[model samples]
Target: MSTFLSALAGGALIGTSAALLLILNGRIAGISGITAGAVMPLSRDTPWRWAFLAGLLLGPVLYRLAFGAWPVVQLDAPWSLVVLGGLLVGYGTRLGGGCTSGHGVCGLARLSPRSIAAVATFMAAAAGTVFLVRHGGW
Candidate 1:
């Protein structure tokens, strides 16, 4: 498949899954929240959370099984930087009250003002970072 078609299909799957989660479970498909709940003391909801996470982990493997090759991932940065970036993203998710999937996908779909603001901030920050890295010699 072409890149655009693959991306579109991926996005459609994500949106459909998010909607299904909300409709069936009455829960936002926020990966960070799901992961935190899964790890922190067991509860009635833990099983589904674990299952959701397992599916996420399995997606690439499933793709490889069907397509005859694993998905490609290229990370230009050092391992240290990658680790630090992951930590920073985790912290930011907590501070921001949600991750992009929650705010950018689910919340925005619900027409939430807070999500609109959060998405705006996220986009501006991302754009600024890219600009700084590419043009401002960061």
Candidate 2:
């Protein structure tokens, strides 16, 4: 499949899963929230949280099984930089009330003003970071 088609399929799956979670479970499919809940789960929330996280972890495996090859991923950053970036993203998710999947996909679909602002902020910050990294020698 072409890159565009793959992206479209992935996006459709994400939206469908988010919608199903909302409709069937009356929950938001925010990765951070789901992960946190799985970590410190209420008795009632444990099963679904684990299931959601398990699916997330196994998605690539399933994809590889079906496609007969794992997706190619190239990481240019150092391990320390990657770790720092993950920590920063986790912190930002907590501070921003949601992650990109939550705000950009589900929240935006719901026409949330807060999600709009958050997504805009995220995009702007990302653009600024890329600019600084590429041009400012950082």
Candidate 3:
């Protein structure tokens, strides 16, 4: 499939999954929250959380199986920089009350004002960061 078609399909799948999680489990499909729950699992919720995480991990493998090759991931940053970036993102997620999948996808779908503001902030910050990295020699 073409890139646009693939992206559209992926987005549809994400939306469907989020909606299914909400309807079936009464839980938001926020990846960071799900991951955190899996890491420090509650007795009642651990099983579903682990299952959700497993599905996430399986996506790429499924893609590889279907496509005959794994997707290419080119990371230009050093390992230290990558780790630092991840840590920063985690800290930011905590400060922001949730991550992109939470605010941008699920929360926006629910028509939340807070999620709108959060998504706007995320977009602006990302734009600024890209601008700095590309133009400000960062």
lDDT of each: 0.88, 0.89, 0.89
Worst 10 residues of 3 by lDDT: 36-45
In candidate 3, which residue ranges exceed 4 Å CA deviation?
A: none
lDDT of 2 by residue, 26-126 (tens): 99988877876788775676799899988998999999999999889999998998999999998888789888888888789999999999999999999
Best by TM-score: 2
- Sort the predicted structures by lDDT, highest score first: 2, 3, 1
Give the clashing residue pairs of candidate 1, or none.
Answer: none
- Arrange candidates, best TM-score first: 2, 3, 1
- Sequence-dependent TM-score of model 2: 0.93
lDDT of 3 at 67: 89
Weakest ten-residue segment in model 1 by summed lDDT:
36-45
Return model 2's CA RMSD, one decimal: 1.4
In order of appearance, the predictions have TM-scores of 0.91, 0.93, 0.92
TM-score (C-alpha, index-matched) for candidate 1? 0.91
For model 1 the local lDDT of residue 80 reads 86
Winner on TM-score (1 vs 3): 3
